[model samples]
Target: MDRSEKTVLTNMCMIYDDDGNVLVQDRRDSDWGGITFPGGHVEKGESFTDAVIREVYEETGLTIETPQICGIKQWPEDDGSRYIVLFYKTSHFAGELKSSEEGEVYWTKLSRLKDLPLARGMELMLRVFLEDEVGEYYIYEEDGEWKHVLK
Candidate 1:
């Protein structure tokens, strides 16, 4: 990696209901557009937590608070660029649902998640967040290959 290389910082949030269903987005215009969660890039000077809240409001027309930092997912590209996706989870939020330019927002039961089309690596991140054993870890990749653990 060189000084000119960049690491992009983004955030993702998984909001669930009492019955274990989660808020999901059926994306049609994004790279990983499919059945995904609410989230986007963290703007300049914005904290990761605040970014998730802002994203939730912008993408779902809802106001959420105290989203717990669950995990981090990173992928290094062949062009020397890197992406850091911060994952969060919240069972609390308030507002009405609204269609977003990003995608069609709705809820899907956890039991049925496997039956839907998921964004690339969505299952990995979801597993990392939902399972306690995985707690926090980072994935280092190059040319679309997982090169084993770094630590």
Candidate 2:
């Protein structure tokens, strides 16, 4: 029997400033609409780090430096394909902050994140990004019920 499966690669970055604020994008897309980090698909032939850097710049107009991979968020699609999101964080960046077609980008205090309307599953994803012990956030099915985990 064949056991190979297709996968999709994507990324997201949590950019921080000296003032304890993090950059967030108020996404306009309906699929995962609401507040989230700036990121996008990893193009074919692009390295994970490179893809995230390009994505951050395209969506936020700021070029990030030395982005560190913190964790991963993944889930299986209905068609049997898997979707994975590489999570990154960085404090070194340059360029004037500007919003792109994807959304309005701005800096907000980390403490205020809980007050805003976040994208679906974003709250759980944050656990992997912020907690040192959590390396992966994912969803799976068992006994016909879906379950989420942070490991």
Candidate 3:
């Protein structure tokens, strides 16, 4: 593996409303262009909770309460490296929705998530996050296109 091929730890915020609708972002300049949650890489010396809070606010313009850690997803690339992403869910927050270089942000019903353009392994990840209890890990491998194997 090349030096550039390394697994990175990342964090994502699943901002949901009391109605179970989740906030999703539409990417305007990413290869994986579609509706996604607000999140980013964990910066040096930043706690997982802090990273998600900062990322969500930066991407959505909303100051979110510290989200509860819900799930962990390992997304493997063809090069054998993967991005380890932590997922959190929070319904309590304060601020107006806004946009950033990350993408346009909006809220969508969880039931309609499958209709939106999402990252390769997001379907399975979302399933695990919604259907399972908090604190679980889901491993996925991209088979080709947007298909994946969940383990």
Candidate 4:
């Protein structure tokens, strides 16, 4: 069996408030509707930290302080393509929230995050972030069922 090549990537800013509420967005484009965090693909030559800061600023108009890595999610597609997404968290930021090509932004209370519609993988990831300590690394399969490879 041939294992698919994996693309290592970073998604920074599970932006949180002092109270621990996370920031979520509603994608304006059909390609990415519903609830999601503010982030995107890391550009070449750009560090993961820098990518997240830039993405957050572009998507939500917020300038985030350096984010701390929280978790890792692996999405392996059937077409032999895989995306290893690095998740980060940050509570320090500045600027007003605004809409962008990415989506409309909102700060969601951690307790109510599940009440909102979110990407399939997000619900589980959020739980891990809340229940666990400050930092951790987890690997998940792309299947609807999230299988953890690390704690």
lDDT (CA) per prediction: 0.83, 0.94, 0.80, 0.76
**Cα lDDT over the full model 3:** 0.80
RMSD of 4: 3.7
Report residue 87 deviation for candidate 3 (angstroms).
0.7
Query: By lDDT, who's the top model here?
Result: 2
Clashes of each: 0, 0, 0, 0
* Candidate 1 segments whose C-alpha is farther than 4 A from its true place: 1-5, 136-151
Query: Which lDDT tens digits does candidate 1 get at residues 56-100?
Result: 999999888889988777877677788888889999999998869
Better of 1 and 3 by TM-score: 1
Candidate 4 per-residue lDDT, tens place, 42-83, comes to: 998999999999999999999999698877766556666677
lDDT of 3 by residue, 4-122 (tens): 76777788888888896999988775477677788989987889898999999999999999599888877577777777888888898999999999899998998899998887667
Q: What's the CA error at residue 99 for candidate 3, in Å?
A: 0.9
Could you list the CA RMSD of all candidates, in the order they appear?
A: 2.8, 1.2, 4.0, 3.7
| Tens-digit per-residue lDDT, 1-151, candidate 2 | 9888899999999999889899999999978899999999999999999999999999988999999999999999999999999999999999999999999999999989878999988898878879999999989998999999989
- Who wins the TM-score comparison? 2
Relative to the true structure, candidate 2 reaches a TM of: 0.96
